[model samples]
Target: MTLLTALLNGAVALSTAKIPAKRQSLIILILLIIASANSFLHLWFSEASEHSTNIFVTIIASGIVLSNRAHWTASILFNWVGWITISVWLELALIQHFFFAMAMSTLLSWFAHLARKKLVTKQIELEIERDLAIQHELEAKAATETKSAFLANMSHEIRTPMNGVIGMIELVSQTELNTDQKNYLATAKRSADSLLIIINDILDFSKIEVGELTIEFVEFDLEQFFEELIHDQHFHARKKGLTLALSKGDFHHRHVVGDPYRITQIMNNLLSNAIKFTESGGITVHYDLVTLGDNLQLKVEIKDTGIGVSETALPFLFDSFSQADTSTTRKFGGTGLGLSITKQLCELMNGDISVKSQLNQGSTFSFSVRLKPPRQTHKMASKPPVPVSFEGLQVLLVEDNEINQEVMLAILKGLDVNVFIANDGLEALATLSHSQRLKFDLILMDCQMPNLDGYEATRRIRAGEAGEIFSHIPIAALTANVMDSERVKCIEAGMNEYLTKPVKIEALKSVLVKYHKQAPAQH
Candidate 1:
């Protein structure tokens, strides 16, 4: 009933307010007076039915119509009173079922409006949350890619110089030198080696972040592994005048299954850190064995007498780029990624790590890993080691740089090989074609050179431009392009082997021996 009245009154107001000359204040006053007149007429003329008294009483009780901004509160109160009054009166005047129907319709309309508003608000909130999550994911992905690229570029830059330094050092060590000169060379070599290790740590951390690093299981001699570690670090410890010791536990097995490279890396990191901070006391590594049915676990502990970490810093010890303190980083120069890599490696091997420390006293780092005992196999008789002599071997050295040429000549001269020099691939081809009696046993062709490079020259040589005498002779690539794709290109170009610069004497010797022995069968 109330709804019917409101619709009727709305229609009346719309029709009257459409007049062009209607004044706003006069419209409002006229609406109020009409509403009041209708209320009083209903009260006076209605019969004493169930709805008569209630509907009339409520309509006459309020004095306003067309509720506006300033009258909204009073309008709401009047609407409720009028609605209840009309509902009661209609029920008495009619079948009494209309009251319940009206009430339900009004309640349903209010609930539907509220539900629509809530759903729209929820949708807006969900949109904001999804946008925020997507933004965070994009930021994380960009940061990860950036870190990977930086580590790759950094590794290449650092390793290039290190290759030169270490190669030169190896060559120098074989030369005749006094005791003092040899000591200086050794020190420089050690420093270069340490720098290489730091570079590797950065690479490892980056690999871990990008999910590219992996561990392999293989059989290796545990004693030999430890021996190499101790030998390598003994010099560093001695330089600091600190005692380095290792204690071994007796096990039935000498060989175990695990990645020797990753294991050595972990031990190296722990030992290096221990020696780096130790000033006056010793460092010790102890091992023990734990058995669980068929599986064996090894517990390794590295204890050092060094400036230990504070209790507060222990929680973040395994976090990347976190050192015990800023002073530790200053005194012992490092990027603080070693322990982080070590911890990651341990977990990859299905192991756990722990640490204990006291300030100014010492620290002990321990890790445990499970290992399978290596299966026994029949040992083949080892080949008798052959004494190497580069005599009677004909070598063609193609290089563009004068310093590099001299360096190569010096190394070859020491090997007692018959060496032929070519400044470029063009010269090398000319030499091979012009000489009637001098046929090269092996060509060490530089990849980048004037006139022609190693690839084209090797192609021409294989095409028999050097005559059948020099054709098919092993052409080993002597280039600085060490990437796997570069090596594949050399092989595809008919070169027998690829060697990266700055080349080491041992590697060069191995290549010589391999080709020299294989050359006879090819001819």
Candidate 2:
């Protein structure tokens, strides 16, 4: 009987589970037949163990039934039918053994039900966490986009007024003035320029944070570029009674491909810091070249005899908006973003920047950038002569703001040109349509004007509704929107050139000269 129960347990476990569901019934039927034959053999021998047989039969039935807990009907039916039928056939009708089998199967089923509940709870918790993570990520992205838009709008609003302030100061300074008045104008100009720099730093830091800043590689004259940069730095250094010098390294590659604008910006930051900190002594800039395989590396070291940094503060030197000490900002007067920007630029170029300094002695800032040598050396052209006169030139100035109109009129008046005013785009278009015979050389169109914006006006002009002559006339977009997308919109609207607000006299002159040279001769 013991052997028969063991065989029955093994057969049921294997036949019910290891077999596919479609064949499980047939396999279980065959195994049952075998169990019955074993029981008959045990009966024929009359030498089987009853206790062991009961234990084995109980374990097998409970295990098979508990394995399918979701179908408790099958579990209960199989437990009662299989064990009771076998017990009756054996002629062992003990009520305790039958009760024991039923009790064990119920216990296992209850335990399985609890296990299923726990698994379901765990899965639900994991799914909830996943959804929350996705929601948070979406919120963060939306907030970043909103911040970018706000910064862009604020930039336009602030820069427009600044343009007028600085431009007006420049115009006033051109006239005769006493030493005191000239000093006041100079101080105002300095303040306006400083504010502009702060705005630029904030914008740049935002760009870097959003990963919008990009690097462009183009061939440029390295030596000439450095010479001009150093000349400007030297002028600033001389004003403070400090000497600024540049020493060239041994390996000389005159022309190389890289982003000249970013390189100039980085150098300007380093040199500005060197000059700002040094009160008594001078600043030295050392440039060297290191050859790595076929590529050449440019290493720049800006050594300043200034109030150096403390050891504890050096670690945070390249961190954004961080300074060496609390008193540093008050004494030096900066947003403390220069070094952070410089370091980021270096890394963008696949290079690195480091500093070595002593609190009272001096500091040396070193950086290295990988560069590609151009196919041939190139020389920079001498600057074009400044355009002094544009007599008989007719320019239509379309602007809504009275102060901006006055500013543009003053600048145009200084150039000895005939200027016509239009308060809005509608007026400018009407002026063009009515005065078809009058040949206008250029149209300075202001974006975001009342009645009609510059973009719409330019589009109409391009469509040739005003006149054939109007369509060919160069329309330059003048506005406070200096964002890349704004420039793209201007171009798409058929504008020839883009000028940002609080337009400088020199930049205005350059634009006029460029178009005047290209402008058709008066009919």
Each prediction's whole-model lDDT (CA): 0.71, 0.77
Tens digits of per-residue lDDT for model 1, 1-523:
4643664465336533544323532454344334534553453456333433333332332222222223323433444455446435544343253445435433543454345346545755887899999999999889877765565455545655565577678778988999999999989987887776776777678788777577778887777778788988898899899999988897756667778878888898899889988898899998876665666677899999998889999999999999988888887789989889999989988898899998898999999877777666444245445337777778999887676677778788777778889999889889999975776788998877779988999999899897767878788888754333456679999999787666767778888887667645553
User: 189 in model 2: Cα distance from truth in Å?
Assistant: 1.6
* Lowest lDDT 10-residue stretch of candidate 1: 60-69
Each model's total of backbone clashes? 1, 1
TM-score of each: 0.59, 0.73
lDDT of 2: 0.77
For model 1, what is the C-alpha lDDT against the true structure? 0.71
* C-alpha lDDT (0 to 100) for residue 43 of candidate 2: 37
Per-model root-mean-square deviation over C-alphas: 13.2, 9.3
Error of 2 at 373 (Å): 4.0
Model 2, span 277-381: residue lDDT tens? 889889998887777887778899999999898999999999999998878888888998988998898888888999999997889999988788876666656
